[model samples]
Target: MFLKPLLHDFRLALIQLHVSAVKSENLQRACGLVREASAKGAEVVALPECFNSPYGTQYFKEYAEKIPGESTQKLSEVAKECGIYLVGGSIPEEDGGKLYNTCAVFGPDGAMLAKHRKVHLFDINVPGKIQFRESETLSPGNSFSMFDTPYCKVGLGICYDIRFAEMAQVYGQKGCQLLIYPGAFNLTTGPAHWELLQRGRAVDNQVYIAAVSPARDEKASYVAWGHSTVVNP
Candidate 1:
């Protein structure tokens, strides 16, 4: 009798978390979401950018923490307990007095798989509407990053980073089957460009793209257009 190769199916949970000024509440909410996803048999859970804090650059100084800080520590523990891969969304990280918008990925074993900082900062200043200067508060990530999972090779990209095609092309060249982007785009661009850019990247790279955004916070300092979605190439 001949034996056949075995194949496995992978399930991903995209968490569109609503961010707030309270850190403890945000973390608790994320942990809860991870637990829920795990209960649903999700092998991997991807979260929205800045899931532990607000999205604006102005709040970077106040919320930034180190890699092994409280947020990552809590997320790692949750991943270990739930036995699911957790993409601990983007957060403000403090390094040598400079801040970085970074994403940390944890394995089911509660190990730090990979970390990718936002390279392409949002430095656009739209006249009479919105102005963003990420460089002013956060240092840009110098290198591209990807990690291996039981399901497939995964690539990481943040909000503004998705607009750059080079990053996705690099991931495609590396044989990544899925690219995850945790973003919180503003109304000025989110309404018109969010989905378009995500789909474009997915089609161009021929890979699945999962983009999660924080639910709209109209009363916050910056309002985000919430429409978290997943796209397949």
Candidate 2:
């Protein structure tokens, strides 16, 4: 069980940008936020889930970008320019006719550090309240991802992955002090279980947890609850 102490100088920033149907604009908006975070003394800047496209699975197909592709290329440059570790939130990934919700982590030199394909897909139906099934379009990732940093090893997961404690525990057991999950929790469940689960994992594992969610946009097809949160244990 590796729960190392965090670096004293570590300052992480969570970017909460409103995503839209426009991909180019969305990327640019994220870039601007990255600069803002860097200027504010954030050594590691993280974005919210589905930062480049709409939160719905229907939009995933249209907006899905290939890994090591355009979205990544730009993110690499941004990380290099800012000289900071960058957590790319989650992007719809298109690989071999299969789509996955994936998040990419970039090193300070702009090199790809690690990529985590969401192992758990968000599939929930609240009857007339809310119904979303990511499994309809996204294939669950089979592996766990953890990357080393000057501060500590960071475990990566996407939205629904938060519901699972085993995954986070494995990361901590293997020597991870920080866990980050880029997510989009809806209005229905976000209010109820979002923070509860975050705090639960942190308290149980004695690790720092950060979960970033897209900014609330009621105008969009799927409205996100819009509370990007953090818990320290």
lDDT of all predictions: 0.88, 0.91
**Candidate 2's residue-wise lDDT over 79-157, tens digit each?**
9999999999989999999999999999989999999999988999998999889999999899999888888889998
Prediction RMSDs, each to the true structure? 3.9, 1.2
Backbone clash pairs for candidate 1 read none
- TM-scores for every candidate against the unseen true structure: 0.95, 0.97
Taking the tens digit of each residue's C-alpha lDDT, what string does model 1 give over 29-117? 99998999999999989888999888787798899999999999999999999998898888999988889999999999999999999
Screening candidate 2 with a backbone cut-off below 3 angstroms (N, C-alpha, C), the clashing residue pairs are none
- lDDT score, candidate 1: 0.88
